[model samples]
Target: MAPLSWYIALSASLFVIGLYGVLSRRNVLIVLMCLELMLSAVNINLVAFSFFLSHLGGQIFAIFVITVTAAEVAVALAIVIAYVRHKGSLKIDEISIMNG
Candidate 1:
């Protein structure tokens, strides 16, 4: 069995990579994908801790996180589609809808 520390390290690495992607990328789709990667890292940590502690709470909470992530992705994609239809581009830096 892999050590808990290894799992934590892996999760942390994934999260950092995702954070960098989200921060540095200009494409909205890429940002959304990076957000998913970050959420996946959280899932990995949850599962790892659940296993290490022999408790189901962490696993259950992870399931809720997955559920929320799915809903978030669905809504975000819908928004993305609308944005593309209106603006014809996916660049996050080009968005000015909130400017008033």
Candidate 2:
């Protein structure tokens, strides 16, 4: 079996990449995708630890997180679509126009 450290390192790497993408990207859709990537990293950590500990708590919490993520994606995408229709582009720099 692969070691727990390997899973942790992989998760951490993905999380850092996602964090960087979210911070550095100027595209709204890309930022949202990076946010999802970060969430996926969290799920990986949760599942890995759950397996190591032989406990259901982490697994259950991961499920709740997944549910919340799905809802968030639905709502966020709706907002993004509306915003794109108004702005005519997906650049995050232009998002400030909505900061009323």
Candidate 3:
């Protein structure tokens, strides 16, 4: 069996990679995917801790996070679709019409 520390390290690495993607990506879809990756990393940490600590609160929080992430993805995709319709591209730099 893997150690708890291994789980934590993996989760942290995922989070860092997600952060990097979010920061560096210029495409809206890629950015949203990176955000999802970050959320998944958080879920991983929560699940790992819940397992190690034998606590239900972490699991509950993870559920809430999943719910919120679903909502966010719905809203973000809607916005992205709208933006694409207006701008004809998903690139962040090209959709600067709202830069007021």
Candidate 4:
């Protein structure tokens, strides 16, 4: 079995990569994908801790996170579709739907 520290290190690395993507990317779809990567890292941590502690709470919370992430993706994709239909672009810097 892999050590808990290894899992933690892996999770941290994935989270940093995701964070970098979220901060440096201009495309909305890429940003959303990075957000999902970050959430997956969190889930990894949750499951790792749950295994080490012999409890189900962390796993349950991870499930809730997955559920929320799914819903978020659905809603965000819907918004992106609408924005593309209206403005014809997915670049974050080009979005100005609220401008008066």
Candidate 5:
């Protein structure tokens, strides 16, 4: 069995990469994907700790997180598609409702 620290390290790395992508990327689609990656990293940590603790709460929470993330992605993508159609640009810097 692998140690819990290894799992934690992996999760942290994923989270950091996702955060960097979100902060540095200009494309809205890529930013959404990075946000999903961050959510996945959280789920991994939840499952790993749940397994280590011999408890089901973390696993349950992870499932809930997955469900919510799915809904968020669906809604966000719909909005992104609409925005792309209406604005004609996917760049984050180009998107703003307050300017209109």
Candidate 6:
């Protein structure tokens, strides 16, 4: 059986990678994917802690996170589609019309 610390380390690494992707990527779709990756990392940590501590709270929170993530993805994708329709591109740097 793997230790709790190992799970935590893995989660942390995933979070860092997601952060890097968000910061370094230029495509809006890629950035959204990174955001999902970050959310999954959080879910991993929640499940790992729930397993280690034998508590239901972490699992419950993870479920809530999943619900929120779904809502966020729905709203975000709608916005992305709107932006693409208006701008004809998915690159973040190219869509600078709102920078006033």
Clashing pairs in 5: none
* Superposition-based RMSD of candidate 5 using all C-alpha atoms, in angstroms: 1.0
Instruction: Report, for every candidate in turn, its global Cα lDDT versus the true structure.
Output: 0.97, 0.94, 0.91, 0.97, 0.96, 0.94
Off by over 4 Å in 2: 98-100
- Candidate 6 residue-wise lDDT, 1-100, digit = tens: 9999999899999999999999999999999999999999999999999999999999999999999999999999999999898879998888788787
Off by over 4 Å in 5: none
Per-residue alpha-carbon lDDT of model 5 for 15-100, expressed as tens digits? 99999999999999999999999999999999999999999999999999999999999999999999888989999988978797
- lDDT (Cα, tens digit) per residue for candidate 3, span 39-60: 9998999999999999989899
Better of 1 and 2 by lDDT: 1
Superposition error at 34 for model 5 (Å): 0.6
Model 1 Cα lDDT, one tens digit per residue, 1-100: 8999999999999999999999999999999999999999999999999999999999999999999999999999999999999989999999889896
The 10-residue segment of model 5 with minimum total lDDT is 91-100
RMSD of 6: 0.9
Off by over 4 Å in 3: none
Error of 3 at 83 (Å): 0.7
lDDT of 2 by residue, 1-100 (tens): 9999999999999999999999999988889999999999999999999999999998999999999999999999999999888878888887887488
| TM-score of every candidate | 0.97, 0.93, 0.93, 0.95, 0.96, 0.95
Q: What residue runs in model 4 are displaced by over 4 Å at the alpha carbon?
A: none
Once model 2 is optimally superposed onto the true structure by TM-score, how far is the C-alpha of residue 79 displaced, in angstroms?
0.6
What clash count does candidate 5 reach?
A: 0
- What's each prediction's clash count? 0, 0, 0, 0, 0, 0
